[model samples]
Target: MTFENSLAFAQEQDKLDPLAHYRQQFHHPVINGQQVLYFTGNSLGLQPKSARDYINSELDEWAKWGVEGHFHGKNPWVSYHEILTPASAELVGANESEVVCMNSLTTNLHLLFVSFYQPDGKRFKIISEAKMFPSDRYLLETQVRHHGFDPDEAIIEIAPREGEFLLREQDILAAIEEHKDELALVFFGGVNYFTGQLFDMKTLTEAAHKAGALAGFDLAHAAGNVPLHLHDWNVDFAAWCSYKYLNGSAGNVAGIFVHDRHGNNTDIKRFGGWWGHDKERRFLMENNFQPMTGAEGWQISNAPVMGMAILKASLDIFAEAGMPRLRKKSLKLTAYLEYIFNQVVAMFPDYQLQIITPTEPEKRGCQLSIKLIGSDKKFFEALTQAGVIADFREPDVIRLSPTPLYNSFEDVYRFGETLRNLLSQSHH
Candidate 1:
């Protein structure tokens, strides 16, 4: 498809978009009676229009039934998380029993590590990526230290080649091999937040297993944005938040996937809680802990109904528009965005912006991270003032993500026009 730097081209693409109606399903923020052009779905997705009714139903149930709402409601709170399980599994390409929605992402990270990061004897090392989201870095560091090993010695960080912004697949495979002897676990972010690079999880998991290490991923940026074959890929364990691509409420409930082999094993050590107890005997309250089978065994508490309601609304949308279909549109939309960005640079050589994200469609999601050559935040402020919602990373980077579910091709074109106009006027 030949690309053009014109609004007509974008509108034409939108006219042909199969998922174009999905834009109406979300509640984009309004500024001065007009909808802001949103591109932060990589950070927090716009709330689904259905979310209000979904949430209000729960609220009404709480008001009417009191404690009885747990067992009897439009959707029972007792098994609320289950409502999300099947679709969540389909989203990640996992078996139904291998996934569960529960605690926040960091909390689940800790719980998953407890079972998967059991270091013993000489195999006490962990390998991870450098510049991982700060929370993940802290989690790994603290977990390593908790096991009586120095973080510096126990955690090996794989970084990009000296001059590059993305990690090389070969370098990652070699790192697994290099640390094979002492490595107990391999952990990484599924899609890097800063560079928007999608690591090859399937290859990474295979390498980790070959090197005698367990593999895990924090899929905050990858979960709903990209296709995952967790079961087919034989990934050991993974976790992700709903707020970003999934569009659940902000800082909402998170979910996890444990391969059936691990999830079915009741012998694995875990920080158990009552909600994970065998449901049939849970009311009996036995002193002995009998865990449920599969990923349900990881639940620490009863589900958060409000957050799960929002998630349910969002997942229903995904179920209607399947991941495969979404991916099909995503590839074309993102390629078009990249093309327009290139056109901007071509039209104005003085703009001085470089796309730090990988050019391969297979290597990235919707996000394109731009490195501004100048240090000022004025450009970002200008974007905000003009009602374009993107993100700014400290000092140097800006991230623009055009979500396939709600963003149209015209949004991409307008973004280019906005930036080009702002820069041109500022220079004048």
Candidate 2:
């Protein structure tokens, strides 16, 4: 499909878009009495309009029933997290039993590591990409130290070749093979946060298993941004935040995925709480911990009702729109954004604007991470002042994610126009 860098063309495309109506479901931020052009779904998604009502419903229940809300209220607080299971599972292509909404992303990863990252004497090393999100880097570093291993020794980070922005697939596969003997885990972000490079998780999972190691992912950027099949990929476990593409509000509760095999193994070591205990025996308060089967077994506490309620509002939208359709629109939306970037680059031939994200649709999500040569945060500030909302990583990269759910083709085109104007002003 051909893309045009014109308002008329963009509007035409928007008119033709099957998912364009979804944009109405979200509350776009109004800056200086105008709606800002949002391109940071990779960071924080636009809030669903229904989120307020979702929270109020939960609030009203609590106000009416007090302690009895656990059993008497609509969507009982005791089993509230259960309401999120089906949509969360569907979002990541997992069995209902394999997924659960609980805790924050980093917290869930730590909990999962306890059960999956069992690094014994010889097989104590973990393989992961370099420049992982800081939270994940800290998690891995501390997890290694907890087991009395030096991070430099136990963590093998596969960095890109000199001066490159993306990790090579061959290099990643080779690293797994090279450390097969000592590798206890092969963990990665499903999509690199900085570069927006989507890893081939299925192939990576296969390589890890072949090397006799467990495979996992922190799907912070991938969970709702791209299509995933955690169960079919045979991923040992995975976790993600709900705020980004999942459209849950800031600091919303996160979720995790455990393959049926692992989830069914109630004997698996986990930091458990009463919420994870068998429902029939939970209130009885037995001394011995009787864990529930499936992903619920990993729950460390009761549900965060308000957060889950807000998440439920967004998940309902996802259920109505479905991943397949969302993914379809996402591919086209990103392709159009890349086309606009190319047009902007052509307009400013001397600006040295470079897209660091992979051009291939299969290797990336909606994010296009651009490297602005000879520019600083000022350039990003200028874009923001001009009403473009995007993400800036330190040094030079600017990430523009045109999410399918809320962002439109016109948004991409307008961004191109804003970028071109900025470049023109810089030269003057």
Candidate 3:
């Protein structure tokens, strides 16, 4: 697939794109009365146009039915989370029973750790990637502390060698084996938030199991951005937020995946609430906690209907487009963005434009983290002022993700043009 830098080529690609219609489904951000080129779907996805209606319907249900909405609304408030199960499972490639829409990502990770991260005797160490998302770092640090272990001694962070930007798969596997004797859990982000490197979860999961450890993932950037097979990968547990590529609103209700093997174990230790108890006996108000037989058993409370409604609106879109189709378009879109980046670099021979994201399509998702050598936040502000919305990581990386669902090839082309112009202005 040869890519051209011309607008005609981008428009033609958009015309031929199977997912082109989805672009109209979202409400793109506008600044100064013009729609901005959105490249931060990896950070926060565009809101689905239907999201308002989804929420309104729930509001209407509340207005009309009040407390009766629990039993009589269009989607019963009592089982609102259930409406998200099928589509959410399909998005991450898991059985409906194994996936549940529940609390936020970090909260769910903490809950999952309670069940999977039991450190005992010599098996108190955990292996993970260095410089993971701050929330996750905090979660791991506090979780390790909660177990009365020094985080420095108990957590083995697999870092990139020397000056490299990405972690080599072999290095990760080797680290797992190095600490095999004491490794109790192998945790990682499905996609590194900074580098956008997609780890080979299947191989990593296998390595962890062989090392007699459980493997889990924080899929905050991977869940909807990449096609995942958590169940097939034999992951012990995983969690993801819905606000990014999943297109749920900001800080929306998140999701979790517990492989059938773990989800089926009713005896697993976890914080429980009535919603997670045996549904048939929920109203009996029994003294004992009879946990449900699947991922729902990990729930700590009942549904947040409003957030779930917004998420459902987006999930329905995912169900319609499907993950395979989305991935197909995503590969081409990202490749085109990469090509544009190369073209920009070639045009600016004096400027150092280094792409830190992995070049291999299989090793990355839609994001391309650009390292602007010798540049600063001013450049990012300039980009924003020019109507391009992207994410900036401190030190020197700018992350741009051209999501397949709403972003077109034209968006990528325009962004390239804007970048070239910015470079030209900076040079002058």
Candidate 4:
């Protein structure tokens, strides 16, 4: 729909939103008793009201049972992370055995790399996106260095062409071809953290495999923001944190997915721990590691019960709402935000407002990366002071994500209005 009468359209759409009631489920931050227009779900999600109850239940268990809470708690702390696996697997489109909630994102990435990134002299290079998350870059560089390879020679960064904001699929394929002989692994963000550009996982994985390389994804920004099918797509492995779009608390549990095709490959090495041992013999404490089948074998430590409590609450909500239903509304909500941004851009022809996120719904998540012309840090500071809760990337990009579960149509409309007003008063 066009935006000539967007203000009226927004009001009407908000009235029709079936998921509108979900907004009240979150505890929105207040500024001077006014609710802010929050669009930073890409960073940290809004807190669920059930989070308090979910966490308090665990707290009560700890208080009452003391050390006995390990096995006697309400949710059974002995296998707390298992409670989240089915829901998380369903959300990411994986089989039950293929998924397991575990350590944080980067930690999982490193662990997965240890098994997937086996570099020989003939296949010693790794290809990744040019501007991955800072943590990911550090992990990759350190991993290469730890393997006695120079980061400069072992890492190949696929960059966008000059003046382009996002990488092209063809360019990525060509890079794989160019490095086929030496490339040991291919790693890319499922949805780029900065640009919100959703990579074509199936196509990328196909190319990586054809080039004799393993393909893995860092799904930190894509996990709950977009639909993924790791098994069908033949992705070797994937990792993601739960805090961002999943509505789990910050630094909460993360997850890993390993396709069942690799289940019998016993030669693949990993950093093992007792938690990953076979449940039948775990209590024996023989010091002999017998890794569990599938992704659960990747676990290195006992599950954090408190964090898993928060994740369970969030997943319960997701199971009730369903990702398919949530994604349908997410597309329309984000598209409406784009439509309004375009409307504002049309009003001031000289002002440049380039959306770095791909226009196609299939190529992006709910987040939109906006590049403002002739603006700086002060511009975003002004936006923050004005009660708009968007995030600013370094240099000159602002990202706004209207979360489907909690963000309403009115929130998108109000954000557009705030941006327009913020621009109107700017010195530029």
Stretches off by above 4 angstroms in model 4 are 2-6
Reference-based lDDT, each prediction: 0.92, 0.94, 0.94, 0.89
lDDT of 2 at 369: 96
Q: Give the TM-score of candidate 1.
A: 0.98
Model 4 residue 381 distance off true place after TM-score fit, in angstroms: 0.8
lDDT of 3 by residue, 213-283 (tens): 99999999998889998898899999999999999999999999999998899998888889899999998
TM-score for every candidate vs. truth? 0.98, 0.99, 0.99, 0.97
Q: After superposition, how far is residue 42 of candidate 2 from its true place, in Å?
A: 0.7
In candidate 2 the C-alpha lDDT for residue 63 amounts to: 94
> Which tens-of-lDDT digit does each residue in 58-96 have in candidate 1?
999999999999999889899999999989999999999
For model 3, give the 10-residue run with minimal summed lDDT.
371-380
For candidate 4, lDDT tens digit of each residue in 182-259? 999999999999999999999999999999999999999999889889999999999999999998988989999999
Clashes of 1: 0
Total backbone collisions for each predicted model: 0, 0, 0, 0
